[model samples]
Target: MISLANSAARRSLRTVSQVRTLSSGIDIDVDHYSSGWNIDDIGEFTAKTGKYQIKTFNKISEKGLARFNPEKFEIMGSDWDSTNANAILLRSHKLQESEIDVSVRAIARCGAGTNNVPVARCSELGIPVFNTPGANANAVKELVLCGMLLGSRRIVDGVNHMKDLGAQGLAKERVEKDKSMFGGQEIKGKTLAVIGLGHIGASTARDAAALGMDIVGYDPGLSIDSALKLPNEIDLTDSIASAVANADYISINIPYIKGENGTHGIIGKNVISSFKPNAVLLNFARGELVDSEAMKEFLDNGDGRYVSDFPDDLLWDHKNAVILPHLGASTEEAEDAAAAMAADTISDYLQTGTIVNSVNFPAVSLPARPDGAIRMSVINKNQPGVLASITDVFAKAKLNIVQQINQSRGDVAYNVLDIDPTANHEAISMKDLQKELTMTDGVLSSRVVFGTPGCGYARNIDGQYWV
Candidate 1:
């Protein structure tokens, strides 16, 4: 029977084995094992078997679409109905729960947030949803800087005034006289409170620090690595109220989750009431994160400024508000990087069952499939004895496990098992093995992958409820 140790112990064993394999110089591709299989090899394998259909929404960058090997992937745009697609890639398109087809194994959003995708529903269906977190950090960071300037200075109003003057044919005469009317305070020496402290938040804080701004940050979920990367000048605060209490500017960089305890209206009356009277609030994250009614009251009651990329009906014509069309990640560089990351993420998950940057599933990865061995991926409910039941199936079939790894997140558990069929006492049918595995109690899905001599690699079996 296969040993079902804890996930941490299994990961440690896998690490030691990898180190030993590296020292032995066994001609194994360690990079491919750690990262993923080469696109060319996947293309070659799919060319002989069948291609994976990728249904794309919105205008995905051509640079990103190129990452998928044309021979192995069929890209379907808006013009085509791709209900049989193996995966979905999109940006800004609000994906409905009903729109997710049964054939889809994964969903990828080109940008950082998965709000546009039906993440909870996808999770229940055993579908992993991916998002590029730091892919557009630089773009959003630069835009946040612009938002700060717009909030502190009268740049937007000044430009509009100039257009009005030019239309009246008094541009040169009124330029000098009207300059003082658009005067505002400099951002230098100002205090900036950054909420969330994720990729975009950290980047914005770093750049703002370079501009001589005092940074105060608040994030309860901050990781050790992320905290270590923060600037030494930043003051860590315990709560949102304390962080923005005395700050000159406040930046909201958190995500928008919809639930009772979620961040849907994180910036409500209590949080807004604690803000400094003349403080400028910047939000490039999500509109739903802030309470619209509370924010409107805050703006109307004081001289504070509200600058955001997301537009709101109530705040659209507010004198203290500066709204811009959502352009946080609209740069060419950001779009290309996001698309490439999304494409590569989808390819790795679909071809090798290696998931990294997944928003809905736990991070799970395994080494390259050894020669003469087949790899099996199983998704099941996280419960006691689930692993035992899985291994019992292999034991009954007389299959020998070469290596295995398992990980869990919340209600879901994922297992990757490498079995050596040659070492089995009796021959087993691949189809029957998969069917039995899928029929196991609590099992959500199962997939089998093996390499062919002439072909690179192929998935011969898949058992999901939708399938």
Candidate 2:
């Protein structure tokens, strides 16, 4: 087995030398060669052998699709069978667990929320689900401002009334007399309670403060970075009740996770009952985060208004409810940003095993591979000795480790190892190494990426090559 491995390694090294000689003139300086090589070079080389198959669902922005180099990827439309896809990029398409095939390495949602995708199932399969958080934050924040104005000023009502009067040919006289009916308080001095101090919430709070609205924020899970972005004058509260108790306007910008302990139906009777009289409630977030029944009762009992980007059957015709067609992130700029972010994220992961902004996986990034090194990525259940066992495989094969990075999130762990063979050591068979790693207990999947020219990439799943 060792002799056969050495023969294959020698052949691979010869192919690498031949390709380099053909691409660049002989006697190239090592420093210049090292400086010039980049991820794009690997991508272009891989393109000649096999391009990564990317399946896109829904209408991804052209700007985002263009981020994928046509030389390195074959982008498929929604009609294509996703069974052989190396990755998926989507926007709001409801993806099922069954649709995730063995060939899939990652899933990138163009927008913030992964509610439309089966995240937990993908996590269990060792798949990192990427979300473009804050990519659409500005868009949603602008719409929240619109919702607040629409709720406070009764602009929709006035417009409808004006249309009716115009049809009756009495617009001039009636407009002056009835304009007072649409009169409402300005948001200048009103207090706003912002729930979930994430990207959108923080952006909303900063803008609202600039508009002279006092801000009260509630987010128990607020990170240091998010808190730093908040306005200094904004008040931070520990609980939802205290935040909305005295505020005239409340906005929910949290994610919707669907479990008893999750954010599903988070806004219930207790929170609604504590709302100040005539308060405006805005939910530009997921509809499921608020209890429809509780919101309906709140609307029925008071002069308060409900404004939402998502439409609900219960509040569809409510006199005090203003529902939009989920247009929070509908702007062209937001779409382009989100699609581009997703494309870049997936590309980075596929080419270099760098993960950022992943919802289910820990953020892990390693420096560029050393010259003539092979990169190996392993996904496994987060358990004791998994890392040790992985290193043991390399030790037995006598592969010199150049660099490594490992991170765990929840039940899964991701490992990336860079291996370079020394002059005295023989190269281990990459296929055998992948088989051994995947066969190891607790391992979910394993992939080997060759930095050596002409070798391309291979993964244990489906035993297919992805250049």
RMSD of each: 9.6, 7.7
- Model 2: residues >4 Å from true position, as ranges? 1-49, 451-467
| Candidate No. with top TM-score | 2
What are the per-residue Cα lDDT tens digits for candidate 2 across 144-201? 9998999898899999999999999989979889999998889999999999999999
Question: How far is 89's C-alpha from truth in model 2 (Å)?
Answer: 0.2
| Model 2 residue 161 lDDT score | 96
Q: Write the per-residue lDDT of candidate 1 for residues 252-357, one digit (tens) a residue.
A: 9998888878898888899999998899999999988888899999998998999999989889888889999999999999999999999999988877789999
CA lDDT of each prediction against the hidden true structure:
0.77, 0.79
- TM-score of each model, in listed order: 0.85, 0.86
The lDDT leader among the candidates is 2
Backbone clashes in each candidate structure, one number apiece?
0, 0
